[model samples]
Target: MKRPITTLFMLMSIDGKITSGDSDELDSDKDWKTIVGVKEGIGQYYDLEQCTDLWSLNSGRVMEKVGMNDKAVAQFKSPVSFVIIDNKPHLNEKGILHLCSWLKQLVIVTTNKNHPAYAMNLDNLSILYQEKFDGEKLLDELASNYKVDRLTIQSGGSMNGYFLRHKCFDYLDIVIAPLLVGGKDTTSLIDGESITSSNQLHLLSSCRLIEAQTLENSFVRLRYEVLK
Candidate 1:
């Protein structure tokens, strides 16, 4: 049960939708700006520069949503290590290489044992293993090997749901924008296998709201601590 202090940081619409649709863009530019502003606030509040790990489940979609093009990617610099969770290692070698070029370290989490034996052999690349995407095991390895105390999970919905279902997340930092993108295909804040009746989250039992604030941009930031 040993794991790092994991936090889920996400931006969602008023209706709790994470993405507009299949597209890798938010509802509007203002929403995107609001997310960035909240992230900056988080950085200041938490002194995030000292954090060693930045995690994401969907790298391509996240990069596109954040408007990280090739030029932006090239100039991107961070002291924190980048950890990507991909069960199948679906990302192309070129893209992985590109990110490894800029990041301090690029760690790929995959269930596939042969992932590291592939063609790309970047300097700061490391491969970690987890069977069937075990969230707790992954975090334990991160905490023990990488010394990632405050790990951030900035990702799409399914991964968020995975961590929540596994009860591996300690903090949930959500920024709710003042807009709603309603569509059947729209992704929600947590999208994964349905939790059974026995395992559903109960208020004040599994989690508790610690902070709630309304930003100047009409966005509401809510922080919740998962009680173990």
Candidate 2:
């Protein structure tokens, strides 16, 4: 069965600048603890317990660059699986093995593995790999593996843009916090093409939360629907 693509986005500022008139760059850390907690809340609100067979969609390059490297495994979701897009021929075996075991539902989208590196590194993990490179096909394969009718996009930036541009995302949730980041090289919580096609989004809900006890501040959570 085919499932509708759902995307969720959460953004936090260094000084709770959700309505700041000026555009400020993001800071390092990106307030991950709060972000993870919000994601957990979303999973609970969505009652993922009834749909435990769902898998998360993400980019393999970003996963290798950040997900595996993070020392404190952010508590985002409970026992959720993932479907990642990675077609690199030189990917290491150790990384794939680690991710496959960690994620509940793991699938890799890649082209033919005919390279020397792939041949040598292919192992038990290779069994979960697929050969489709497009976003639509990737989602279909994920639905086949898990009975997913929705998707939540945890950003690394580029992957988010690709999915949104393809109109594969059907929902967006933004968590705004109080902070100002004047950093030069940092990135905002969300960035993408101007969405040339007229797409209407309806507001699903809004809530507020005290994000961090250590920091002692509140944040606004806004959920938007990418009209079907």
Residue 72 of model 2 has an lDDT of 40
**Top-lDDT structure, candidate number:** 1
lDDT of 1 by residue, 49-80 (tens): 24424653344446444543433245676665
Of candidate 1, the 10-residue stretch with the lowest lDDT total is 43-52
- For candidate 2, the per-residue lDDT at 172 reads 64
Which pairs of residues collide in model 1?
none
Candidate 2 wrong stretches, greater than 4 Å: 14-54, 67-78, 89-91, 111-132, 182-185, 192-216
Local distance difference test scores for all models: 0.66, 0.50
Give each prediction's root-mean-square deviation over alpha carbons: 4.7, 8.0
Clashes of 1: 0
The alpha-carbon lDDT assigned to residue 215 of candidate 1 equals: 67
lDDT of 2 by residue, 1-228 (tens): 385567555454544322223322222222343454333333332332234235566555555545353334333433766666666642355555556556565555666565222443423233334555577766775567556776766645555656665667666665554445444334445444444443533212233332323322444455566654
